[model samples]
Target: MHPPRANRAYRNVARVLRPVLYAITRRDWRGTEHLPVGSGFIAAGNHMTNVDPITFAHYLYDNGVAPKILAKSSLFSVPVLGWVLRTSGQIPVHRNTSQAGDSLRAAEQALAAGECVAVFPEGTLTRDPDLWPMVAKTGVARLALTTRVPVVPIAQWGPQLLLGRYAKVFKPIPPKRVTVVAGPPVDLADLYGRPLDAATLREATARVMAAITALLADVRGETPPERPYDMRRGGGGAGADGPAAPTADGAA
Candidate 1:
């Protein structure tokens, strides 16, 4: 397996940001052995704060896998940030439109090329009050099964200290300790080759979420709730059923 390639833009960005990130946070990253080598894979992680993505990216980059994250399309329109994202090969997700499927297709192509594709399976930051993972959209599951790629469950904590959920302030003053753990590729062998029905997707997705939640539990040194929070039924979500699951053929 060839080591993942990093473009010049990604390397330059990392060179600039890595030192600043190290200065701002005490890192406790584990499970490097779980990341797949010489192959493409999906990284499904829980979202707590806006800052977690940075920390998460730092972890993967340091481990030698340059992550291709799925970010909202709106971010690609920003001035300098957009240019960086585009040039760095990050994929844009066009939400709630006929073009929504395009993102998954792009992801599939990336995976086929042996690149790492990262996604926040929860879709948005957790609203569990205590920052536990909520019931996630099934897009991650869809991607894993359709592409038959490894789905590595990653859990991140401590970024909220830098910037709390939905908060606009970045308080990196005294610095903070950010912990991240990556679990082995989720075992979906039993479900593979089965029909991609609602039940199958939910069960597969639940496994993915559970793996992530367990890693979070390890980082937090506490037990998680009996079940993940449901953002739709609880509040602050879309239609009655929540976000629609992405199709295997590539609709997200």
Candidate 2:
């Protein structure tokens, strides 16, 4: 019962991927009731492996929603893949150029048009040695505040079994079971209507990350790290060129 307004290209792509999706993985999605009824919301989740994006899209589609992603702009440079992205109404993000806000504007347009937008706040995969969530960027924060839409914090596990951040291995002999759980919409009412300053955005981003981390902890039945991984300072976090930096499929 997915919303019927999804672009024809999106539906076509889904039909093509449905068979392959079932071949390599099993899905366990909770918090189905938390999904917004119609549209105009963001689904923000942790980044672990490249496979999670499609699987997460599967999750959303199965729950009667279509996913429009904020993908890297470089992906739009490809011939065939880029065509699919454009036809499906997916947004491209310019991570390097001064025009990065273009991606946000595109996303805001999608949200306003009643499209369900998905984003990964951790600009890259977690460099955490233990694969826990690390510090995240404020893109999701900016999106939510600007549109005043619900930011649903989601957690997904087991995609790493099929493909991990640093590990290029793909072991699908038995078909791994991936668990995705969505928590309630993050509350940013107090932060709303205020100036979109770094401090406010940081606070909103922390709340979004905390909610996702808590759901992830529930999925793993373990406690998360006290601090998020910091890749820039070269602390205990894994290096960007570390195991998870190779491909951009599950890219930020």
| TM-score (all chains, Cα) for each model | 0.90, 0.87
Task: Give residue 98's lDDT in candidate 1 (0 to 100).
Answer: 88
Worst 10 residues of 1 by lDDT: 242-251
Q: In model 2, how large is the Cα lDDT of residue 141? A: 80
Q: Write the per-residue lDDT of candidate 2 for residues 65-106, one digit (tens) a residue.
A: 887878777766666557656776777766656765677777
All predictions: root-mean-square deviation over Cα?
3.7, 4.5
Error of 1 at 135 (Å): 0.1
The alpha-carbon lDDT assigned to residue 111 of candidate 2 equals 88
Query: Pairing residues by index, what is the TM-score of model 1?
Result: 0.90
Question: Which ranges in model 2 have alpha carbons more than 4 Å from their true place?
Answer: 76-87, 236-252
lDDT of each: 0.80, 0.76
